[model samples]
Target: MSSRLINEYLREDKLPHIWCPGCSHGITMRAIVKAIDNLNIEKNNICIVSGIGCSSRAPGYMDFNTLHTTHGRALAFATGIKMANPKLKVIVITGDGDCAAIGGNHLIHAARRNIDITTIVFNNNIYGMTGGQYSPTTPQGERGTTAPFGNIDKNFNLCNLVKAAGATYTGRSTAYHVNMITKLVEEGIKNKGFSFIETLSICPTYYGRKNKKGNVVDMMNYLKNNSINVKAAEKLSDEQLKDKIIVGELYKTQEPEYTEEYKKIIESFQKER
Candidate 1:
């Protein structure tokens, strides 16, 4: 049953969301709502932006003002909104293929600029909305429609990549770890500069069957069994950590936010004029 808090955030007319049974995207969506509730953020002041994909469909069910943009361009549109009105909190909801593949360039540059946007990437490891095709985050050797013989491409460690690109806050959590996901998301939103979170989600319809990963329950358990807390990961060697997922905050640092910096620049120019 959806909690009172969750129901308050959703559009009741859009009840029974479109995601397939056993898909974790819905759970991830709830986590986002839970976090926002914990922070007591005014829904009207928040703008949710999404790119094209199954993950992108989320905005339609949300009651807040939202933008369902073109493939891989959610971040670009979000950037514009943030710059135009820095007081509005811009939250980006995107999928693995939408963010890591097509939108990767925008993702990195946004972090580098330290824009005040909270980006939540639903990393299901495959292209769930489009077909069961391999995506930038698909685990090596996992089967996809495009890789019927098992995938050979290397996967991206998105948190690490974004941290390197200069996101002020970076974290990871799974749909199975609902409370943890909620906490991290709240922390990310409170952060002053760009914040990027990667939520490892399940696409049981596509990723699971194609990879011979039993059922939804089994897949959810896989996340619990394979994950290691970042504190404990410090003692493990690279080889020892190869297949283990690292949970918790990976990086955070203070920086001048993009919009604030732009405001300063404009004021200085006006003074000179």
Candidate 2:
């Protein structure tokens, strides 16, 4: 099944992705492909956009209408594509820094507008491509190249941020939870308004070595042991949930999608004319 999906949806010429050995971006990428396949969406109708970062490299390898935009601007470019052709299924593949740091405004505004775009954030906690810099999602007290001692900033809860910013759908999953990532992404795609899915990936080369997170298997094990599904978390106490990663859909609701509302205004003007 994996080989068949790769043959059908991936650019074989780009074989052997550049992510470090044990990095989980590839797993998250595969989940995206599987979600698209499950929906049976035509390749031609999908537009995958990305900004500068490790995760952004995914669009280049994906067999679809892909846009490799400037750093922190994937959401801006995606917004244009969505506005120009509302019928297209626009998906943005971005990293934690690319999306939440430099592209933070775009993220919030896009959500505020409730645009019909699925944004999948491959958050590896650190700035993997640019260097081992601490990212917006990097846990406080974690070590990074920029923070040799420890990071003092409070990390952002991305799912909560997006949901509060007006995203109609929001969810969180990790590379260890591959099936859940696919399921959240699939559901996000099916939603009519802005959708955000944060996939916690592993940056073994940088994040692991800096913070002593162990190897790929160890990181995966940590994710498995520390994460609690939102539904299951309901029964757990605050102490049981401390430092625990919340997985599964965090929020979902219907809203006026930007493109659809824009189309309605155009139609109204045409009728008046």
Clashes of each: 0, 0
State the lDDT of candidate 2 residue by residue for 1-273, as single tens digits: 349999999998888888899999999999999999999999999999999999999998999999999999999999999999989999999999999999999999999999999999999999999789999999999999999999999999998898999999999999999999999999999999999999999999999999998888999999999999999999999998999999999999999999989999999999998
Q: Identify the candidate with maximal TM-score.
A: 2
lDDT against the true structure, each candidate: 0.92, 0.95
Give candidate 1 regions above 4 Å deviation. Answer: none
Give TM per candidate: 0.97, 0.98
Error of 2 at 28 (Å): 0.6
Model 1 clashing residue pairs (backbone): none
> Which is the leading candidate under lDDT?
2
1-273: candidate 1 lDDT, tens digit per residue: 677966799997888899999999889888898898889989999999999999999999988889999999999999999999999989999998999899999999998999999999999999998889999999898899999998899999999899999999999999888898998999999999999999999888999989888899999999999999999999999999989999999898899899999999999999998
Q: Spell out the clash pairs found in candidate 2.
A: none
